[model samples]
Target: MTTRTLPMTEPATGLPDRITIYEVGPRDGLQNEKSVVPVEVKAEFVRRLVDAGLQTIELTSFVPAAWVPQLGDAEELLDLLGPVAAGQARPVLVPNERGLDRALDKGVKAIAVFGSATETFARKNLNRSVAESLAMFEPVVRGALDAGAWVRGYVSMCFGDPWEGPVPVEQVVDVCARLMDLGCDQLSIGDTIGVGTPGHVSRLLEALEGAGIGADQVGVHFHDTYGQALSNTMTALAHGVRVVDASTGGLGGCPYAKSATGNLATEDLVWALDGLGIEHGADLDALVETSVWMAQQLGRPSPSRVVKALAGA
Candidate 1:
């Protein structure tokens, strides 16, 4: 793969010129939580996320209710989004054609497809081999494209897996290449177990570049288990990647990777970006407040280090 170390981002600058915060509070953030967030609350939370100026929100997953009862309200939640705001994009997660059909039935204009980078993960997590899962999604992607929907491909455990040691850079890039070739508008690479360091992140992105995926077509999904999400984010930004995945209050942990935490907090990402002059329109105070409200609704304190620090509770 084509890999290169990128120049560092100057700490003095504020947030970047424009940043797209893909809010996963509903799907990725909620799927792994022990307590169930009421359907109405989830819907209101989604509306709140949009009201908070988040332009792209990953709403919910169309996975079977039997698999993820927490997201059983996907259809109801999608209905509550009302309509796409002037410039916002609402994307939902789909596991296959059945899931995509459910999402499309709700008229979702953008959708995300989930896959794994490792064969073991693919088999254990999705009940299929890596190639088998990708092949299954072929018709789904083609159908979504034909329906004029923007499709995003997700490669989970891009860096490491709980069952596996350090994931090879080549494996990550290869899966990414397959997804990108399937007419996916974007590919989100996830650090499922949060075991990556800034240097590892740099190397991975460099590999994607070598694999012919442009920085703009790539998105980063990080968990804060190692407390290095922000630093690795810096590495991602330096390589010209534009999108990031964060959840409100750091809502859910990685289900497969035992003891793993949830995604990086939106507040932390926005804080770091704000300090970099990156110009993300996310309201840190409001986002933190949203986290506080959701945490209270969930009858717990937020897991986000940034949210906890800001709440001063």
Candidate 2:
């Protein structure tokens, strides 16, 4: 794909004074893990994450346990999250109105609404047409915002899809516009199967720009299945997207989406930010320690190069 060049923002130069690390290890991360992390362990993970300077953390999703038994304790997880500091935020995933009610009842401040960029995946994942899902979210987003809660939207399979192969830039732009128009505080474009290259990422950002969604309202959520998350992320950064989604120790993968491994590890993102002189406010050593703890609890080797390299280095 031929890429059109865009004027780059001043790269995030200087040692990162701060980068908001949204910890998805509980919701997106654990949902894909094979081992069901105990509730105590899950809460402990959140506790540790906050201690590591990740103020924005995803607690869990209220989706039916039948859909993701790994996070059946969404309510419990939210309730058990000891407490938040004066300014910290802990967001949770809500599938629909029912999920939103459950999360709201548990005192969630931020909630996420998810939709896929591919129609096929949207139908398969949400069991509804794209229009139907948007219709469903309209009320959900509206209700959440009305309740004084911050609402974020997730756009999955931004670059490509498992069932239909590569997704079109037009498709991504249109869907993302709808999500933003629905009044999402921010939107995360996820490469569900990690098939995105830097070129694909650039085109998608340009398409989003063409659609008039400001760069500040967008985030890139990459899965490292094809080993392209970091470069793709840097491409997003150059486009002025600041927010990013990552999990500790590279945890999480799409159980429904084949070969879509865990997200770009938080450790890896911090490493890149460190090299770029961008501030993330994260304690790398503590973050790595948490990642190792998470990997041990899950009984899996971390997919993060930083984790392996640092542990050995």
Candidate 3:
């Protein structure tokens, strides 16, 4: 295949050529590993991702250290990154007001709040009902937005859940609406257990459209548990979704969802986008190298097909 040098902002595809790839490897990816990753290594991991041209990276989480010791160094990590400017979008995951406060104190410009579309997941992950969880985020989201910080809302299990099975589209739409009402700048619909097919992805987007949620403010996060992540992402792109959440080297899994697996690998997503002539402003070779280096740090080979293929190539 010949690589074309077309303008990034104006691809031949009707879809928006330049998509924002929100990299979540530093926080979501490393959080699932049982081995305690050193904070220095985690910071270095973030630096590498940025060098690979990732504009928005979820740096870390501000949850209780007791709950997620892996990201307990969130403050230190932010300090290491220094002040993040607008458009860079280094959002940290905040579980509550305290977490939001911590992020604000660090001069962080963006943050993400996690919500679940299923009651069981909400109860297990947040210790609150679906409505209660959204309510808890109300103050957090409001506070962040009032402080002029960008807020992103994540609705997990939008397609299916291991425990609850197929999640209702209506439930997801309502939850996303609440998040939007709470002042989230963007909503990332998630297929946490990766059971979503392309059809499911289209239907969910259609349902969201009917509920007045445009694809511009929507992003998709998919795990590759059943190998549908890339296909689902293509469906999302076709629906005009321009933001995607991916993990480097196919890293990350929900600690709460025991059966969940790797996130849509950054390399895989970039490869598909590259082949499609869509612009993501990423250096594919650099991304592959970063994944390979991070895999060495984790003492494992990358699970991404693109990563493995690139190494052999």
Candidate 4:
């Protein structure tokens, strides 16, 4: 319910002076954890994120409980967040029509469908080829749009895949275009294995731009496995990307990539934005507190450098 924007002009480098940091801690962060976090805890996690001025939170996923048992309490968590009525946008990840149905039944106002840019990743994650998986999502995307829900499309392994190395930028651009043409209101390009560098990020965005896909419709998701997430994010910003996906406490990894590390920490992103004179509207101290609280819940130290430094660990 708080105003998330500040008045600023677009810079000479084409970056928006203000950016929207899409918080994905509750969903992507916790889904990969081995422990089954309590539903009440997940509810509170989202509540605290809202309190920290994260207006857009990826709350949960509607995947099969058999696959991701940690998020089995999706409905209960949503119910708990309902009473706040804070008008923060809570978007859930739905893998297929069945998952979309579960989300729509719960009155989900926005949903995201995930796809991969490479065949190997698609097979490993969704048990289907890239083409076939996108085929499956067509109907799911149509259904969500028909139900008057906002749709976001996620293309994983945009830069590198675990099984297949260094994906071609042209292939990534083609797949992203397909998602956009399939009616996704926005497309989140993911560096699933955390292997992207600033040059790679710049090339991908330039490819997308060459293909007539504007940065306005694209968001970037990066992991800090190689410690390049923030640097790559800065590259994206210089190219006009305004939305970036980050997880609180640096939690989350690709379940398919065993060596992959946690996501780009929200605290680290806030720190960078603060120093750059950019506006993201997040409270860094509050976010660090949330990370500390979550690290305790997970029974591990947070992977974020900022969190560790601020926590004086």
Candidate 5:
């Protein structure tokens, strides 16, 4: 059966005319899986995403197998992807210098470094204080930039932390500025625990702008734990953010933050953007089909509302 079409466009004012949906289903979405996905399946998944018109898909991370065994086939997966990985903005997450080296050796042209907005998370996730983590990332970011590759810096737990509740906006801004100073081309602010509200999202974006980090160079990554991911994304778009990070079937959460849930689903995001009359070059039917297939592979129904509704699952 053919999938359904999206809602008719109703353009929203004060939002960017076009939006870039940075697809993370292949990397962030599958990272926390209990069982590893076959590299061949991962290659097909990426190929399907590219065919679905997602121009920027994060392929995988170069972290050690002991860290995230789910993505241990990173090199093999890339080798399988071959030219498919070359045609689009395929960014990989690199935890440190060694991760960066592996990605570079694989001819990766885009890389992202993950950072924490709270000290507790920094220690828990990176085993280092915030200062120490940033220091370590400095050279990694510089090296990627020198190699003429694009670098993205992710600031996690931007709104609230599991250990340290209600993170101050200024604290997030400081970390964001530091990441940018380290030569990151873009920064993706993450509500890692999904405890953020629209007001909180606005305050954080405004504070970042005040700190000289404009929405043009920023992206928003939200989780659906609190059922606020879509609303928070709308708030960011209203503030002029053009890049959004989403997983294909609402497929990922932070392993470090137990409270975190699945990410903002790409099908859900596309549905909202279509309703808002924004230009995001994704094929809704294609995305829903991909999510449905992936959900079958994972032995569960897709959590994406749009995918379920459209696929009639």
Candidate 6:
């Protein structure tokens, strides 16, 4: 006997008809692992994500091995994946001009630069002041754009910083604007410590709009430390944002921010989108299976509630 199931679609009035899930499992998800995940396993993870119908997958970062040893095989992994076909957006994280040079040499067409909204996080994560980090990114973003690669700017700690406590909406807006000015095609606002509520999310979006940065040009990346990731995501969707950053099986955390937890799980987000009647092109069953396999690789069960429930079912 076989059982069939489908979520009841109740479309929300103010949300976008379809939103792009910017899948970050390969890069952001595995970056904090203590043990090195082999290049072949990482390649298969990317393949599984593609098979699960994720349109925009962040493949890996080009930071030095000393910085992020988990993704040291960026070039080898890209080689395994071969040429990115037309219509597929596979973005790699480039920390500076040197990383950008390496990615461009590999014929990378999409790249992202990670930034911070607060001075403390900037110093801790990048070992530079916020201004200095932006200065470093200016040339990198320019070089990527000049090379015809699509660039995304990621502003971490948009909601709250462990060292700084609550981050002001105005501060986040300012950093986002600076990143936009750096020629980034899009900006991903990150709730690095998972401390944002729905109200905070709304106010931040409003402030960003006041600064001339509309939701159309932004995506939301939420961690689940406080279990508000889905609620915060709903708030963003209602505010006209159409892109969301999520990890498979809730796999990642910020290494610099020890208080931070796993990212907003892709499975949970997809389930929420399914119920909301929002169009996110992902196969729920395939995603669940992929997360289960990945969890096995990491020697633990998935932290995603949706993945657990579905996998058990």
Instruction: Give a tens-digit lDDT track for model 2, residues 90-189.
Output: 8888989999999888878899998988888888889988988999999899999999999999999888887888888898899999989999999999
Write one digit per residue (lDDT tens) for candidate 6, span 1-313: 8674567888878888899999998998999898999999999999999999998999999999998899899999999999987788999999999999999999999999999999999999899999999999999999999999999999999999998898888888899998899889999999999999999999999999999889999999999998999999999999999999999999899878988889999999999999888889899999999999999898989999998787872
Show where candidate 1 strays beyond 4 Å: 1-16
Mind giving the per-residue lDDT tens digits that candidate 1 earns over 1-313?
9543222455553324776888898888888877667888998888778778788888888988887888888888877667777678889988889998898888889999989999888987789999999999899999999999999999998889887788999988999999889999999999888888989998989888888998899889998888888788888887788898889788767556675787888988887776666777787778888998888888889888778777863
Q: Sorted on lDDT, highest at the top, how do the candidates line up?
A: 5, 6, 3, 4, 2, 1
Winner on TM-score (3 vs 4): 3
- Residue-level lDDT of model 5, residues 164-255, one tens digit each, is 99999988899999989999999999999999999999999999999999999999999999899999999999999999999999999988
Error of 3 at 172 (Å): 1.2
Task: For model 1, give the 10-residue run with minimal summed lDDT.
Answer: 5-14
What value does the lDDT take at residue 118 in candidate 5?
95
Supply the TM-score for candidate 2: 0.93
Tell me the tens digit of each residue's lDDT in model 4 across 106-176: 99989998899999888988999989998999999999999999999999999898788989999999999
Q: Ten consecutive residues with minimal summed lDDT in candidate 2?
A: 6-15
**How high is the lDDT of residue 179 in model 4?**
84
lDDT of candidate model 2 versus the reference:
0.85
Of 1 and 3, the candidate ranking higher by TM-score: 3
**After TM-score superposition, what is the CA distance of residue 277 in candidate 4 from its true location, in Å?**
1.1
Q: Candidate 6's C-alpha lDDT?
A: 0.93
Query: All candidates' lDDT scores?
Result: 0.84, 0.85, 0.90, 0.89, 0.93, 0.93
Which runs of model 2 end up more than 4 angstroms from their true locations? 1-18
Using TM-score as the measure, which candidate wins? 6
**Clashes, model 6:** 0
Q: What is the overall TM-score of model 3 with all chains considered together?
A: 0.95
